[model samples]
Target: MGETIDAGGVDLWVERRGTGPDVLLVAGLGDTAEAWQAQLDGLADRYRLTAFDNRGAGRTPLSEEPLSVPRMAEDAAALLDALGIPAAHVAGFSGGSFIAQELALGRPELVSSLVLVSTCARPDAYFRSMTGFWHWMAERAPSERAMLEAFFLWVYTPRAHADGTVARIVEETLAFPHPQSVDAFQRQLASFVRHDTLDRLAQITAPTLVLAGELDLATPPRLGRVVAEGIPDAEFEVLPGEAHQPFQEVPDLFNARADAFWREVGARG
Candidate 1:
C-alpha cells in the first residue's frame, strides 16, 4: 500500500518496501510509482526501496504552478527530508533522469549514487521533435486509449511490438485509472523540453551510472552517451535489444546490472 506525504506543499503518494540502505526510484514522464514495480520486486529484497508518484502523475494532484525540473528535484529532496532519510541511491528513467540530475546538482549530500536509465543531458532537435509529436498526438487523440496507443509506438522496440509485448502494455495502460490528464501531460512535456544540464553535470558528485536501451528511439544511445560524457567519470552501458523501459522489457538483465551497481556503491561507502 502507498501513503501520502507532504513534500514542499505537494502531497505525493509514496510506497516503501524491504529493508537496509535506502534506494529511491523516480519514474518517467506521466508515470506512477507503480512504474518501478520490477525494481521494487528485484531490489527490495536487499535494500529499502522507495517509489513515489511525481506531481501530476498517478494519484498525485496537479499543481497550479508551472512545473520545472529543478522544482521537481526539490520535491524529491523534500520527500527525503519528510522520510527522515539523509541520503539514498537514486535511480531515474527518462524524464525522471532529468529530475535526478537536478537533485544531484542541487542537493549532492542527499544522493549517494545515481543511476540514469534512458536519459539525456539536454534535449536535442531529435528529442524536441519526438516530444512535440507526442504532445500533438495527445492533444488530438480521440480518447485516452488512442493517445496511449500512439505513445507506446515510440517507447517500445519493434521486437516488443512484434512479440505482442506492446499490446499487453497497451491494455494495462488503458485500464489504469488516474492516468495523467491532458493538461498535466502538456506541463510535463514542457518541463522535458526545457530540461538542460549538460554544462552543470560536472557538479554532480555522486557515483553515476548511465544506461541506455540499444533500440530506444526517444533518448537514444547517443543521448545517453552525451549524459555520460557530461558527468565526471560516469559509467555508461547499453542494454541489447531493449527500448525505453528496459526494466520492464528485460527485468532480469536490468535488475542484475542495477543490483551490481548498487552493491558496488554500497561497498565504496
Candidate 2:
C-alpha cells in the first residue's frame, strides 16, 4: 500500500488497496490518504482503491513553496502515471473535489468518471470565513487539540458533533505521527479559495455524479446542484440526515449511489 512519485519537485506518498477498476480517492485540506480509510475498506473489495497525501501533508514531504489547486491536480495525475494507471474513476470530497474537477478539465484523458461529494466550484464569502477560522485555529490556537476540536465542529453536523464523532475525529487527528505546519495549511487554504471551475466545468467529458449531505453546511446542497447543472451529463444525489462526510457517516448509502452511477456510466461508455 505504499508508492512514491516525484511531483512538483517533491516526493509524494501514495497508497492503494484491493483490485479491480481503478478508483482514486482524494481528500480535503489538512487531510491525508488515511482520510479514506472507510472508503478503502468499504470499496476495496469491488475496485482498485488508491489514495495519496496531497503536497505538504501526511507522509508526503512539504513542498518547497506553496502549491496551487491546479498543481495538486497535476500531482494526482503524476501519481497515477507513476503507478502506470492511465485512467481512473476519481472521487473527491471537499477540496479534493475541486482538484477532481481540475483533473477532469485539465487532464480529461486521465479521468474515466468522477464523483464530486460535499464540494463546490467556487468559494463564496461564507466559505471563506469558515476556512479562515480553520487557518486561525491552526496558527493561533493554544494547542493542536483545541484546533482539531474547532475543526471537527466546523466539518460535522450537530448530530455528529454531539454523538462523539468530533471526539473520534480529534483522536484521529492526534494519532497522525507527522506534524503539520500552519504555513503548509495556509498555502492549501489559499489554493482552495482560488478554485473556480465554473467556467471550465462544461469542458469535462467524463460522466459525473454530484452527491451532497442534507445537513452539510460546509459545502451545502446547492453546491452539488451547481456542479450537476454545469456538466452536461451529471447526476445529483442528496442523502437525507447526513452531513459533510457522508461516505463515512453512511457508507452503505454512499457506496450504493456511487456504485450505481459507475455502473450506469460504464455501460454508456
Candidate 3:
C-alpha cells in the first residue's frame, strides 16, 4: 500500500516494499514512484525500498511556488524523517540524481551511500537547449504521441529503437494515469536549467556510484565522468549499449551493479 507523508508543505505519495536496509529511489522530472518499478521488482526482495512521487509528479500535488533541486532534496529528507529513518542508501535517476547530490551535500548524515544514474553535475548550453526543447514540447506538442516521439528520439539509442523497446516504453508512458501537467513539466525544466553542483560536490562525503549509459546523448558519459571526478573517490561505470534510461534498458546489469553497491554499503554499517 502507498502512504501520503507531510513533507514540509507538500504531501508526497510514497511506496515502501521489501524488508532490509532502506534504499530510497528518486525518479526524474515528470516521473512518479512508478518509474522505479523495475528496480522495486528486481531489488526489493533483498533491500527495503522506498519510492516517492516528486512534488509535481504522480499523486503529489504541486504548489504555485517555483520548484528547485534543493527543495526537492529537502522533501526527500523530510520524508525519511517522518518515517523515523536515520539514513538510507539513496539512488536517483536523471533529474532525480541531481536531487540526490543536493541531499548528500546538505544532509550528509541522512545518506548511507549515493547512486547517480544517467545524471549530470551541471547544465551547459547544450543541456539548456535540450531542456528548452522539452519545455516547448510540453507546452506546444500537438498530441501526447508527438511528445513521446520527440522524447524517445533523444532518450533511446538506435539499438532500442530497432528492437521495438522504445515503442513499448512510449506506449506505457502514454497509458500512465498520473502524467505531469504542462506547467509542472515547464517548472521541472526550469529547475533543471538552474541546477549546478560542480562547486558543491566535494561537500558530499557519502560513497557514490556514478552510472552512465554509453549511448546516452541527453546526459552523456562525459558528463557522468565530470560528476564522478567532482565527488571525491566516486566510482564511475558506463553501461554498454544503453541510453538515458539504462536501468530500464538493461535491468539485469543495472540491478546487479546497484545491488552489489548497496550490499557492500550495508555491510559496512
Task: Report the number of the highest-lDDT candidate.
Answer: 1
Best by TM-score: 1
Deviation in Å, model 1, residue 17 alpha carbon? 1.2
Over 4 Å off, model 2: 7-9
Model 2: how far is 9 from its true place, Å?
Answer: 4.3
* Model 1 clashing residue pairs (backbone): none
Which portions of model 1 miss their true places by more than 4 Å?
none
In the range 1-269, model 2's lDDT, one tens digit per residue, is: 67777754568888889988899999988888888888888888888999989987888876576578889998888888877889999999999999999999988999999999998988889898988877777889898898878777657878877888778878878887976788888888889988999887899999999989888988999988998999987988888888889888778788888878877878887
Per-prediction backbone clash count: 0, 0, 0
Task: In angstroms, give how far residue 200 of model 1 lies from its true place.
Answer: 0.4
Better of 2 and 3 by TM-score: 3
Q: Against the true structure, what is each candidate's TM-score? A: 0.98, 0.95, 0.97
Better of 1 and 2 by lDDT: 1
Q: How far is 44's C-alpha from truth in model 1 (Å)?
A: 1.2
Tens-digit per-residue lDDT, 114-183, candidate 3: 9999999898788889888898887788998889888888888898889998899889888888888888
Candidate 3 lDDT for residue 78: 95
